[model samples]
Target: MGTFDAEGVYHPRPVVADDLDEATLEDAVVRSIVDFDDGDIVEGTVVKIDRDEVLLDIGFKSEGVIPARELSIRNDVDPYEVVSLGDRIEALVLQKEDKEGRLVLSKKRAQYERAWGTIEKIKEANGVVKGPVIEVVKGGLIVDIGLRGFLPASLVELRRVRELQPYVGRVIEAKIIELDRNRNNVVLSRRAWLEETQREQRGDFLANLKPGERRRGVVSSVVNFGAFVDLGGMDGLIHVSELSWKHVDHPSSVVQVGDEVEVEVLDVDLEKERISLSLKNTQVDPWQEFANTHHVGELVYGRITKLVPFGAFVQVGDGIEGLVHISEMAVHHVDLPEQVVQPGEELWVKIIDIDLQRRRISLSIKQAAEGGDVSAEYRDAFGEHAYDEQGNYIGYDYSTAEFTPETEAQAAWADYQPEVEGTTTADEGQSAEPSDD
Candidate 1:
């Protein structure tokens, strides 16, 4: 057969086609079919969606079968949930012909192949990848950024998160910290992204915070050394030393996680982006309170709380302790504080010096023996008759003493007077480190 073209050229068909047999015609049709190999990506339209698999028409002799397992990065998902009939999708050719003589394809693998090329470029350009959290695996989560991207639990937030399940289905942005295509590994850090994005906000927060200024915040976390308080914009650390006016054994003993507290800003390091806060500074200082009510050369009854090599700590007021150096323990030479007084023993002592700045009080048992004006806290307990015109302790009979508030207070003062000498005990001596303000 021949046909005439618009250019007036005559085209004649080959005589070989006119003599072709049915077997030859079938071979020619087979040769015209499109072909693809393993790992080759192909575009197709979803033709059938079964419970176990999806059939995609890629213009091949047989429809490609995408098993439900290969439909998505997620496991155990229904084929209908992944794709609908007549919907166009891309899939990677897994096998030209399986044992069942069907072409096998993987949608997830195709997506992974495409994603890797984009992800590598992003990593090179220092870009961020965002996706929804698909699963919570051990020690981390899996994000579907076209492929399974591993987001570690520790990198999910500025602080390590103990519960990762809540992150599932939540879309988050992250920076690629590590990537290895051969191992099928992609490590991400959402914390890196957060820190980069919040750097400016933190700087502003720190700039506005001034020393000695008080701010209210919620305790975000508690650690052995300190507690971190979230002050709206950023978190600041309250060291254990500044947790209380009195000595604190642990940060938890004073504040717990989620506690609302007023804290004083002690310092701010703009270069380091750190804030130092003090919980005690916002409260009354016990040392300052004791100093206001007491003075030098006054007699105050106290209990020997601890005996150290250099001194003995005497509890004079609530949460207030004064140190009696070994040299001031008595008029006579004393080798150890325990030689002049034993722990838990009660006696009167005179205040020698008070250093509010150093948070220290010096007491002297030897000077107290000379007698002085009793502290106002205990002056009422000692009747005027108990002291001479010179304010020296004279003899008083307890048997004749009437049961009154003064006597009750004196009784509560415990036993022993300033004139009493140290008594021996069989108990072993103990020592303790002096506390600081």
Candidate 2:
């Protein structure tokens, strides 16, 4: 060793250049190492590897010792994989001197100091945090984003997740939905994945629908007013009024969840993002069939269903019903419909009037004429007939065979000509063709 004087000239101290005192040098080094303190964050070059500890040289007389546990932040990891000779690593000094007079250093605490701020920034921005699934815990799994994060059993997805083992040893990106640094806990979620996807699907669904389009869907859900159906990817509402031409009490009466159905698109409300569908619109309207099939004076059998103050409703067919008013019930007189027939009673009714556009049909039981007197004019026009209690004609007026008039004047005059002889005329309402007399 050399000493520097005040004038900056060096003076050498006595020393044996040969046969060096190795033992005294070792003793001084040990004494200097014991004087060092722990809990100091320091930098060092990886010097040596002993049986279970890593030796680092930080320019101290004696190198610091980091046992296998203190060597890395992760569990069950080999220190050789993280550091090598000549590799410069920084660590926190844990013990000034251990029982073996070795300085103890830890790599994990050194890493933690650099990690906390980065984690906080990611959480504040509501950004995605990347991590490795390091361990599987009781209610969730642990991840390493240079810090411990807890992902709950729930919130794993938009739907519930049943198995979590497959997540281990895998690295994934998750939204930091919850964070608390004081307790060193972090919670993450994949719900953002599901919501974003459904939003996309909803937009696609709206684009696919339009008015008067015939399409099919499944009954997705039932409410008091209607059923919500899944039309491919979108949802539509089948309102109760549109369910049937008949009567519908509730949607559940005819539809159920998961039931596949065909529906007609009646209207599209883009502003409200709603669709109105009709089940009955997809079928043949019976009132339309009735308009084409029946006429005045035509006889039809119907089952009495509902009674009201004005009339009784008779179901003639699936969706066709006629109302027999109280006045229409008697050629003579009647107080109530029940006075002529009871509900569920099947009877012959004559079509008195029909409004195809309004879907109303006026029927008369009295037109059957079961007991009321038939005028000679009607008897001659319609033939001999029996009347029902409500005045509905029940028997054929056979006078079609006995009457004939030769001319227009003769035909018009036939009714007034007295029932004295044979007659054939259209004013008597004869057929257009006359038979040879």
Highest TM-score against the true fold, candidate: 1
Best by lDDT: 1
Error of 1 at 104 (Å): 4.1
Model 1: per-residue lDDT, tens digit, 92-197?
9999999999999999999999999999999999899999998999899999999999998999999889888898999999999999999999999999999999
Clashes per model (N, Cα, C within 3 A): 0, 24
lDDT of each: 0.82, 0.69
lDDT of 2: 0.69
TM-score of each: 0.73, 0.54
Show where candidate 1 strays beyond 4 Å: 1-40, 57-63, 95-104, 220-224, 249-252, 308-311, 325-340, 366-373, 379-437
| Candidate 1 clash pair list | none
Cα lDDT of model 2 by residue, 317-365, tens digit: 6778889998877555667767766788776566778898888889877
